[model samples]
Target: MAAFTAADVKALREKTGAGMMDAKKALDEANGDMEAAIDALRAKGLATAQKKSSRTAAEGLIGLAVEGTRGVAVEVNSETDFVAKNDKFQDFVRKTTQVALGLGNDDVEALKGSAYPDGGTVTDKLTENVATIGENQQVRRMKTVSVGQGAVVAYMHNAVSPEAQDLGKIGVLVALEGDANADVLAALGRDIAQHAAAMFPLALNADGLDADVIERERKIAAEKAAESGKPENVQEKMVEGAVKKYAKENALLSQIFVKDGKATVEEYVARIAKEAGASIKLVDYVRFQLGEGIEKEESDFAAEVAAAVAG
Candidate 1:
């Protein structure tokens, strides 16, 4: 049996909506013959999955799952919202989230290369899906959160499909460090994560604040301080004080609680820790807003229609 090259596998996969491994299997079974591989896929009825892969998959689902001491979140994109509503697409999202949780890596490329259930690598499966679905789909991003003694809680906002389980467009993961029970910590975590999504804090604490961001603020503060016409030393002190205020405002632990707008986040977490009888440490968190930086291609629908008619 001849070994199939990547191009051979890709071409076979494109012809039959089957995964890369499946395509290779077919190709190998066919003795590296492309037509034979297509016939092999047709016999299996999985060829359609390959045919649909070329279509754009822009609208899909964000999936979240929590098990044991860890939680995972994943974003799988499809070409249309209709596909997102499809049970098949939803299942893909769910499975992808589970795969992401197991990998425990934040890198998208790594996750794509990670093993997928039912054979073949995730990348291979995605390629087959692209061909089968007839749309350009993507595994956009993934993240996992876990702790030694604590719980990592997750919340998905505005679930249009069965995907978004909690709130709006924001998905968050908050890690609490302590021996807290999953149920109790999860409740608190959801609230805190939701707050984080709403507030968009810059860092877990003042110490973790970005140095460049701090410097930029310092420059702005110095300019503002100079406007007061104070002495050089006094202006310097004022600028320093201003920088401190800026840090307090942007840093997560220092930000005032959004719910009550009274106590700082640190104080609030302290209160929770006391109530829970476990020391809680805010290790880190992640918040993702759909299409945050991706600039969508803008187009005029009417012009498109006119062009189609003219053609």
Candidate 2:
């Protein structure tokens, strides 16, 4: 019998970021000694997994899965675009998105805990994948959108290559709610989703914009207005006006639809609604632009040369 329990293996894996099987094997070899197992992993260089996990994983595909009225978008990031192109990595992302779609909501922690289609949990699989692929990967975020009565459409933008189907750097889902024709709803949602993919709307509506984002815009507007030698009252009005304009430009509903450049997104939806013969509402949406906020580390050649010389 193995001397270590599954919890011991899990702890070791968490501490060292080693894969489940390797952690268990190390624990067994160390006769259930946590410290000894960690040492063993360190000697094998697998203990560096924890450090690798901290590296920016800003290059990967956005995995998307849509089923009828519901759709899920998952962002699985890797250390390099080369890894993103790996079949195993792509397969892992695709399976992860499928698992997330089954979860019915966008809880990333729960998704990680959920069982993978393979023999182990999603986290276990991810850890093993990282070890085998020799690169750190992260299942960062997932969003699930559904409509009570309508259709949710999906669009993937800028597929890495011709072979990369149904996966892209940007994945968008648009849920349109109404009892209108499903086909019509799907068509309209696809159009909207494509627009979202191109335009990169920050939120569904002006009010949905983040407070921090709005505040940042306000600060910029105030500074610019002050530079105009404007009075306090005018500056205050200018700030509000600029903030409103920012919100309008960044929100999906108020932004001009890119397809024709004439109608606002909401207006485009209303025009489609007339064809559908019912009221249509874009109730929810999710846009997963890969690595949107992650700051990738730039390799410093001078520092590398200095460190090498020191070594």
**How does each model score on lDDT?**
0.75, 0.88
Every model: Cα RMSD to truth: 8.3, 7.2
Could you say which candidate leads in TM-score? 2
lDDT tens per residue, model 2, 98-147: 99999998799999999999968998888777765768899999999998
Q: Each candidate's TM vs. the true structure?
A: 0.72, 0.82
lDDT of 1 by residue, 1-311 (tens): 47668899988766555777778888888888788877777656544545555544446677777777677777787766666766555666677778888877788898888888857888777765655554556888877777787888887777763634732256788888887666777777877888888888888888989999899999999898889999999999999999999889888788888875898877888888889898887787777675555555566889989997999
lDDT of 2 at 35: 97
Q: On a 0 to 100 scale, what is the lDDT of residue 102 in model 1?
A: 84
Residue 298 lDDT in model 1?
Answer: 64
Error of 2 at 13 (Å): 23
User: Model 2, which residues run further than 4 Å from truth?
Assistant: 1-46, 161-164, 301-311
| Clash pairs for candidate 2 | none
